[model samples]
Target chain A: MERGGRFHTKSAELLAQVTWEVAGLPDPEEERKRQAAEFAALAAQYHPHPPLARNLIFAFLVGGSICAIGQLFIALFQSLGMTDVQASARASITLLALGSLLTGLGVYDEIGRVGGAGAAIPITGFANSIVSPAMEYRTEGLVFGFAARLFSIAGPVVTFGILAAMASALIRFLVTG
Target chain B: MVTGNAIAIRQASKRLGHQTMRFETAPAVVASASVVGLREGQGPLGRYFETILEDERYGERCWEQAESRILKEAVNTALGLAGWKEDELDALISGDLLNQISASNFASRNTQMPFLGIFSACATIAEGLLLAATLLEAGVAARVIAAASSHHEAAERQFRYPNEFGAQRPMTAQWTATAAGAIALGLPADGGGGAGWGAAADGSTGEAQLLPRITFATVGKVVEMGQKDPYDMGTAEVPAAWDTLLAHFRETGRDPAYYDLILTGDLARIGSEIFREGMRRRGLDVSSRHMDCGVLLYRPEQDVHAGGSGAGCAASVLASYILKEMRKGRFRRVLFVGTGSLHNPVSIQQGEPIPTIAHAVAIEA
Candidate 1:
């Protein structure tokens, strides 16, 4: 199907509605067809590649560079006598905090703008993912408010990942038995 | 006197038409317009060139308007199908071009749903959809949205040059078309689609529910061609698309025969050929109803620079073009694989490699 610029089709509908409402001219079918045709014709012109790769690199560098700073926290956890798991967990938290800070400072955004996936690649992406939603939830409340409400977007990924991981572990145990 | 007409319009609005959701939503697209052909004899908007191109403001203004329209429609349609209202949505997942992200950010400022800005290049659709599907399956939220947009002008100006750059266009660069798109999803629920997702919104009141869960999504490995040439995107991007498609098929352990249709996002002219050949070489016979959105969208005579790339390029194609075709019972199940070149020009300058990513999502008819 052609969702490419399909919004133009929506414009056709809006135009038709407008014409009908404005003139009451027997549904103004011609205008709808004309607008649709115009959109299609315009769309038919030569297309170009957007600066996607360029943006991704920028996002990657910024997000990744910033994330590198967070990675240092992992070393701190380890040197402070934390276990590997604890280090990793604490690292995740620190990364999340740094991510939120970057987000708040609007720095992560520059990374997003340039690196695209490069920034989105590492743990920073996930950290940004959670913090982004959390920041949005702030408008609603910190407690049982916007934060909980915001879970709908990223909530699925975490839940299913855990479930799937658990399921995999169960399968391994059953096989061993 | 001015107040009279305004009051009249407001009063009429209280009486007719479809119901507008009760949540705040804003426009998402942004652009800058300029005209040259007029001075040199191009298209007709020629005479009105100065009036239009005189300011990039209109172009950018129109962009967000279009983005908002398309984005909102996308979420609304999905919400409608799921029978959910705007107020119930948790947040929006989106990606686009621009550091400021005016299109997506401004768009979000008005939504009842919160926002997350993601930039996976054209992979934004797959990326956002991946997260959305993931969130839905976990029952974390009843409804969520993943959307992206790329303004032809904004992308061109920022990434390359003005429209006239077509003459100096290297084989490496492809053309960005003017388009925008958005999508929405709802999760499995006790009775309806889900808790936050309404079952009685818009046309969704009586529709069959969206699939129970998105189930699984595989983020692609960064595959790259040693060389970087914008002109020959086929060689550059073919491997990435092939890698992801093959991996997804492999992980699922499902034969290509099981799928009703398989599609790739924006693998235009050269890349399309490379993809087909690469698949053949891999010993995978996807000879079924497999096709590329780029090829399907236009007639060959209409030469796109290399092909089309943008969130809307595929989103619009999938939502409007493909959805329209689906009504005809063309296929029962389909796979939509979105490909992206996650490279930055800065990396190329720094002599870094061009890494790419592709994400795949399955749509059942």
Candidate 2:
């Protein structure tokens, strides 16, 4: 708030003026006129919905694309008469491996390059990080190799989830046993 | 014809407050005694550096960190060359590139002088000089030190990443190299040399740090070329530099014929040409004095695809070459402009062209 005798509104206006004075530029009125014109033209080309729309479409596309690959894995396992849970587990594993492969090859980043936010927000994105680096680190040694790292990221996630599941199991047992 | 005296050389600093934590400072002091955290990762050793360039290429980050660590060094170096103490001086005026200005805040933590913060992105160092000059001439304080800084790790984490799980980045998104920088200004009576940091001893009220007087800094005409990528900041930086250059010439009542050097912060190679051509179209001839910070760091052999950005690139170079030239009195006058593009992915994807800004300070040695 401004001190007494100087209105807050006027002080703000003055502060705006001071900014111009310091920059050695013209007064606010001139700049305002110039900005108004620039903004009017910009409004025509860019739409608020395009990027968001493009992204929504992309998420469905990539998510669908990955899901389709997962479906193929499921079909392969099911045709061989695997259990439903078995097929689902096998599909996730296949994707985890695939994600790791793209990540290692640095190809998934290419997809991200084209889609911007489109490829970014999906479960497959996480798969890429864990798998890619692990695969890249393969040359380091097998005791610490690619197959070993298949669980590097998944390792932590599973560990935490299992611990959480155990705690949840204990709580349920205490309440309903 | 000489306008001022002391020259600023070498700047470094650190940030202490706010990491994901919300901190508070007086509105006036907010700009001073501040370090910006793009994320908690920017300071000494953070994860962002590990993934981006690896340890072998940490030289740029080290120079950057040194640049951040040495704003006080540059000021003190100039002061050492000048020979002055804290109380013998007046106040410290400075700024930084953080959300809350942690760089200057952390920097001021070590010094005994008062802090006045500022924000003009890469232009703050020169802007700091201009402010220090104004105060010296205004008799606000007999001597004052001004400074500014930036960091990459912190900036990237805050602006780009909330989580690293597997975010794909764009090429236009130049990695904000991790580092810090600082500079000190003074207007002392005696020319007796040797002060903290290094001193530009020969400059009196008529030397680079003291006298030339910051008559004005041109407010740039920001142009949004509608480049949507948060990665391609050059689009905005080039125009800002070009616009600022034109504004500098027009405001000072001269053409490009007036300056021997016109330097822009962090515009790199692609930006340099765009800025030069952009200015040429305006009928402003810049045969000389048109250089970019991106051009100076590393050689073509280093293979930095797009070149460099980040507050340190310009601040460190300014501390080394430009400030050295100022101290030698090689340039009677120079126009240093720092260009920055205000951008975020949210805004870009919302289809907004990045709004850009540049600040210009004319110096005489």
Candidate 3:
């Protein structure tokens, strides 16, 4: 398959110190550049053009709506006489529960489909990732199916999150000291 | 007793039109059954399917196992409807979307018949039908069954991402159909001589003659047009579909107007448009008769972005809607082009271009 390359023969082995070199040396860098350009042209035709403006509007609206709902919950909690921190915590919990519930009921999937990253960038979307897998694997059983798959997507996030929190707390303590 | 089979068995003739095969004896689809999950059962052609599970699980351990179980049920239903016992089948050709086609293997294992495991990715149903017809044409098999299946969650987990990953699917991404379909092919029972099997043996004779027959098939070549995006599969597969359709027309000396309908399997909306445009460029306008199984499988409001896709997407739709409509005299001649993206997750990860193939089967009433 190597075109123009010299082939080694039985008779050539006896011709010691007389090397039969290839006709032309192939340049790796040059070949790579050519291939890259070819791929780029093909991709330009094959790859779908992103609708940046429309997507931006969708993301802004959906993300803004989710945050607005969260703020509403916070305001309601505060009106009920809870402290600011407690109200904020309660509002986040409510949003997470609603996200998981909607996901389990198959509504969040539709929302995520059209909302795109707008729906996915919020705290509820995180809850969706955790709940969606669990709901899908529910047929496997409660412990093995649901519980096992529940963390398949969120486990790494939790792992790094705790580690980062610990490091940040240590730095804060050292700086204060 | 002689089984009312055909009087003369022709020799194994090769090369029909171009890459097409003309069976000496067209194999008749005696019985067929389509089984789908809850989501698919709610689609437009839901009532046409033989079995619709209220629950997606169907009493299995996982989505994969559920897929296998439904496939087995579909095959069993087809056999039962044909009034043929398990031992009557000479061979079972089957496939699924799972690795090694385990769902089909599992389904076939239950029958204990001679099984052929085929994998054309999503085009497996068409591939199986062509091979089954070839067996009948060669006079090697009296009765044969071909089936294929897929589960949405199972296919997603294996091909793209885990359902729980909360991965945002692009608009171009398609939904994998959770369904199974089985078709039975056999010699004409009412042939002049009592040389073949018929209704007296199984009590399904009344419905035998109405079944659509497999008349021809064209095997497609693998075409790679340097497409790499896994999400946008339509652009990758449309070229292969167009190539095969052109080949079928060229080899058969026919035009797009020859068929009542020309359907492509699981191209969805995006691929369907590309296929139509490609055909138009080739001087064959098929927009009037052209339809896609992917786009037909779901409602727009269902939020299936590109449309439905999978081995089951074509298999179930053909077995239920197309065959039933043909039986009702809605279509006289139809061409089904089954398109498959023969790429694995590893291939996509390695940045290899997706290679695609499409097989066409001509079914006539």
Candidate 4:
């Protein structure tokens, strides 16, 4: 379904009444057709034609760099005598900290703007979601403002993640035990 | 000495002229005031505004309360300038970008006057004017205050995203103007003598009060071109603006050349181009005299991509810059087409397309 279809269906009845009153139209079908054509012409002229290949390359490069940094952090922590699992956890925590700091300093927004969803589909995006609303409502005070709104956007993600984890655990217990 | 035939002919009303309404007794804008925040005060038309706030909060606890304060200041200033008290006002028509129009509603609480809260998104000023003019022409209201306001932070949290999110905005995104504007509308005080608040009522300057009068109004139809991206609002609004302009011309039988200035509510830079190009193709080229309040509000160097927007954008510009220019005899006639994209964050998230509207009011000096 086209994006315009959503608008046309929702507004058709009311818009028909308006056009009839304003244009003094004799036929509703003809006016609707004319409007549809006009919208088509406008869409043809202004609709963005994204460069898929270029976008894919940027996404790969940015996404790979983020992962590479995480691996380096894990390796460095492991060399310091930590277990593999412990190192991985520490690396993820470090990345989350950096993402939150960048978001607070107003640098992450610029990167997300230029990189599009390339910057948003990563763990850094998760950190941003948690930090963003907290800072926005700081004026509302700590308890009702920052704390209450801290997980407004990321709360659903955390809820679903825990739910899925519990289900996986229950299945494993039933099959193996 | 006047003949009965002449009296009957004069009294015969032309109820419908195309899609427009021609007023027999046009309501005049006697006084107006504009109050803006720091960023807006730094814009190109900053000097013309009545008050420039150094702080967005205006000493309020929250951004919403700050917006309400801006509205109250604008209304009070306008009333004071017109030498009228709140008790004298027949009704107050106001709106804002906040949900339930809480900004205007809360601000009007102290006025103790009859309140009419309206919402047309960014086209609120024109809608307020249209309703106020209707009341004045019908003799239901001798004096009315029309106002609209918008606050960047309050609007951001409500309609878009959290301001602290540092979300990267697209180049198509427009900055909401943190401003409020109000205008006093009334007829000549007496039987054609033009005494109270007329052109000569500006006693401070010892010059005639040369106020602008709203002569005609064309209520716009909601038009949706199916552009759903909220950041690129100009695209969604252009078609509605064109529709209203076309309707106004068709109804009035006047071409683009009829007015010295033709202004759109807040099409900004990108939408203004689309509007001009679209009109050119239809053989109604208004590029020469066409200007947008969004484009004029902020300077290009300000980095307000696509320029300023919001209900207050056009309202502040009209009350401050445009009205002052008209009083100076710079423009004899003007047409203000206020365009609005009627969509909220919930609707956009649900994959709904934006519906748009534009209301036009013809003001003459």
Give the best candidate by DockQ. Answer: 4
The TM-score leader among the candidates is 4
**lDDT by residue (tens digit), candidate 4, B1-365:** 76887555445643345467766688888788899989899998988888999988899988999999999999988887777788988999999989899999899886677899999988999999988988998899988889999998899888877765635566678999999999788885522212333332233354544668888899999988667889888778998998999989987889999999999989888888888888998899999999999899999988688888888988899888887777667888999999998998889999998999999999998
**Candidate that beats the other on TM-score, 2 or 4, i.e. the better one:** 4
Q: Where is model 2 chain B poorest over a 10-residue stretch in terms of lDDT?
A: B21-30
Candidate 1 lDDT, B152-200, residue by residue in tens: 6556544552221112343334555344455556532322333322222
Q: How far off is residue A114 in model 2, in Å? A: 13
Tell me the lDDT of model 1 at A31: 56
Residue B114 error for model 2, in Å? 1.0
- Please provide, for model 2 over B237-340, each residue's C-alpha lDDT reduced to its tens digit, 9 standing for 90 to 100: 66567666665665456676676777787766655666676576678867476776656644444334455566655655555455554554665466778777
TM-score of chain B, candidates 1 onward in order: 0.72, 0.69, 0.91, 0.93
Higher-lDDT candidate among 1 and 4? Answer: 4
> Which of candidates 2 and 4 reaches a greater DockQ?
4
Taking all chains together, the TM-score of candidate 3 against the true structure is 0.77
> What is the clash count of model 1?
49
lDDT (0-100) at residue B319 of candidate 2? Answer: 50
Q: Which RMSD does model 4 reach against the true structure?
A: 7.2
Higher-ranked by DockQ: 2 or 3: 3
Error of 2 at B226 (Å): 5.4
- Write the residue-wise lDDT of candidate 3 on A12-130 in tens digits: 55343233224354454455457545544543453355667887888889889999999999999999999999999999999999999888777887777567788888899889888
TM-score of each: 0.51, 0.56, 0.77, 0.81
RMSD after CA superposition, every candidate: 25.6, 14.2, 7.7, 7.2
User: Whole-model lDDT for model 4 versus the true structure?
Assistant: 0.83
- Tens-digit lDDT track for model 1 on A54-112? 65556557656756776687788999999988988888877767666776665764555
